[model samples]
Target: MQKKALIAMSGGVDSSVAAYLMAQKGYDCAGATLKLYDNPQCSQPGERACCTPSDTEVARNVAARLGMLYYVFPMQEEFRKNVIDKFASTYLNGGTPNPCIDCNRFLKFDALVKKAQELGIDYVVSGHYARVQKDPDTGRYLLKKGLDSTKDQSYVLYSMTQEQLAHILFPLGEYTKAEIRQIAQEQGFINADKPDSQDICFIPDGDYASFIEEYTGNSSAPGEFLDTDGRVLGKHKGHIHYTIGQRRGLGISAPQSLYVCGKSLQTNQVILGKKEDLMSSSCLVNDINLIPWDHLDGPVQCKVKTRYRQPEQPATIEQIEKDLLKVTFHEPQRAVTPGQAAVFYDGDTVLGGGTIVTEAQLK
Candidate 1:
């Protein structure tokens, strides 16, 4: 019997090419598009929203062209509970959340993997630009950066477990974005030339505060902006409207530029300070997930990426407690925000990552 695979098609050129590659490899393939959200308020007119009707239609068309069975899994409720709710509550609690990580953790890897198992599928495939390989020495799976360095997505995928890595496939790991697009064009995929979705799929306009307010039906109360010394600077619209390291739209005039340094949920204050004040040398990470090893026995020197777009910095990671890691940077890192992931890497291999909880000044 032929091995079976389920392709999680997002109606993009990358995923379409992924499905095509899997099918060409002689795996009995099926396509699935996750219907994650449906509210018109969450999407803008004339904008491409993942899992929308048009996206699903394109995915279905691609599946038909590939002669593969296709299905739409309605995951709106799960997405709301896992991604949207977590995003809103994290902001409400004065933390910056990465919903894409949550989506991959809870939806694609966890939920969809279960769905594939139920259908007797041997593997689940997607279009992520990351690679997985088994280390022959340790017989452990390793997640590494894609061949195209600029398009690597291993940062957001650090949460994948060894089991998931064993069964997941990334067909685009070795292919560049341009190659994927060309393949899609050759295959006549409808979304071959479609621009990649930029903003959060649900919040296309990028008004996070407004969307959270409308979704939760509760507006954030106005708060005071404070300096590092707890001195009042000015009033802010709300704490939710700002993030650490933000400098613009502060609605305040000062002799020097001020950046958001922190937020106090208890006091409902947004803290602003000079750029130098944003630097932190160490941070405590929780909800830790280790990829290359079962446990981090001692301090390990590696590069750490605090945000998706930020460059990796030299850091030493030490396991201080169960489910806790202390990442001390060689130099002060700016805007070490809580609720964002601190993904550790050893060269191109992902060592592991976790949620950043708190930071401390350099000694």
Candidate 2:
């Protein structure tokens, strides 16, 4: 019997090539693009969106060209509830949110799994640059980095579970971006030269606060900027307009340059201090998800990354309390912001990760 697979197509070169590769391998395949959002507000008069109408048409055409079945999954409500709303709320709470993680957790992996099950699909395939390998000893599926170092996407995928990893396939794991583009060209894909989406799909301009205000129908109220000593520095535009480690756009004059170190929800104030004030030795993380094992019996030293593009730093992971993990970096890390993911990596394998909660209690 042929193995049935569903390819999550985004109409880009990577996904188009992924779909082609699966079909060529003789897997029974179908293509589907999730209609996540329209972004009627954030987009300008003429702009290409990540998953807009044009992209959908291209995906549909590609599926037809490949002689496979295709459909559009209208998932606006799920994307808004799970991703956009959380992004706005996290900012309001003084923590910077990573919406891409939420998108993968809710829309791509979880929601797609349910959809595939309903259609009697045996496996879910995507273009994410990651690999799934089974540990011969424990027989557990492990998430490993892609062969391409520059295009590894294992950080945002840290929320995947054992079951999810079991039924997922990444055809681009062993290929570089250039190779993927070449494959697309060889297959005569229309989007062979299509550029990758850079900004957030919905917020085309990257003006986060403006989109938050428009989407939520609430304005960010003006707030006070306070120094680390609790003295007034200046009046800030709003708390939502600032994030930890931000140095520019302060609109303040001081003897020395200042940076945003923290925010106080209680007083609605933004904390400003010298660059040194943002450095921290440790941080607490919640919502833990580990891949290789069920739980950590003891401290494991590995490389940890607080942001997606940042290089991993050496750190020690300890499970201090239920649902909480402590990461103590060998050197002081600057701007260990809350609401970001702290993904732990053991060489090319992902050990686990959690949402960074705070650096306050770690002190």
Candidate 3:
């Protein structure tokens, strides 16, 4: 019997081509588009929102063209509870959260995989730009960066477990974005020329502060903007309106450029300082998921990426507690924000990652 696979088609070129590739590989393929959200308040007109009606239509058409069954899974409540609520609460606690990681952790790999198992599917496939390989010696699944370095998405997928990695497939891992687009165009996919969605699916306009206020039905109260020495520089609209390394819209007239260095929920203050003040030599990480090893017995040298878009920096990772890691950068890293993922990589292979909790100054 042929193996059955569930392909997650997002009505985008990458996912469309992913579905096509899996079908051609002789797998019994089915397509699913997750209907995550639809509130007008959450999205803007003319903005590309994931799981919208139009997106689903395109996905359905692609599935039909491939002669495979398609289904739309309603995941609005799950997305709200896991991704959106976490995003708002993280900001409320003075941390900047990455919702994409939460979505992949909870919805795609967890919920979607469960759904596929219920249907007796052997594997779940998607268009994520990352590769997963099984080590013949250890029989362990290894997650590696996609061949297309420019579009690699391994950082957001670090929380995947061994079981999830073993059962999931990323068909676009070996192909570049340009190659995926070309394949989609050649196959006459409707979304072949569709632009990639850049903004958050829920916050299409990119105004996160306004979305949080509206979603929670509570305004972020005004707070004091304090300098590094605890001197009041000015009044800020709200702490949620700022994040670490933000320089513009400070509403302060400083001789040198001022950036948001930190935020204090207890004091209801946003700390501003020079760019150097944002640098930190070490940071503590919680909720760690180690791929290469079960635990780090001692300090292991690897490159760490504090944010999704930033390049990885050389760091020494030490397992302080079972679920905690201390990452000390060889050189000071700037704006190691709390709530963002600290993904560690050894060359192209992903060692593991965790959520950043706090930063420590260089000794």
Q: What are the root-mean-square deviations of the candidates from the true structure over C-alphas?
A: 2.2, 1.9, 2.2
Q: How many clashes in candidate 1? A: 0
Q: How good is model 3 by TM-score?
A: 0.97
- Lowest-lDDT window of 10 residues in candidate 2? 40-49
Candidate 2's residue-wise lDDT over 29-99, tens digit each?
A: 99999988866753342244477677888899999999999989999999999999999999988889998
- TM-score for each of the candidates: 0.97, 0.96, 0.97
Predictions ranked by TM-score, top down?
A: 3, 1, 2
**With candidate 2 superimposed using the best TM-score fit, by how many Å does residue 305's alpha carbon deviate from the native?**
0.3
* Model 1: colliding residue pairs: none
TM-score of candidate 2 relative to the true fold: 0.96
Off by over 4 Å in 2: 42-48, 359-363
1-363 in candidate 3: lDDT tens per residue?
999999988887888899999999999999999988868755443456565677778999999999999989999999999999999998988889999899999999999999999999999998999999988898899999999999999999999999899899999999999999999989999899898866688887789999999999999899899999999998999899999899999899989999999998878999999989999999999999999778898999999999999999999999998988999999999998988999999999999999989643111
Each prediction's Cα lDDT score? Answer: 0.91, 0.90, 0.91
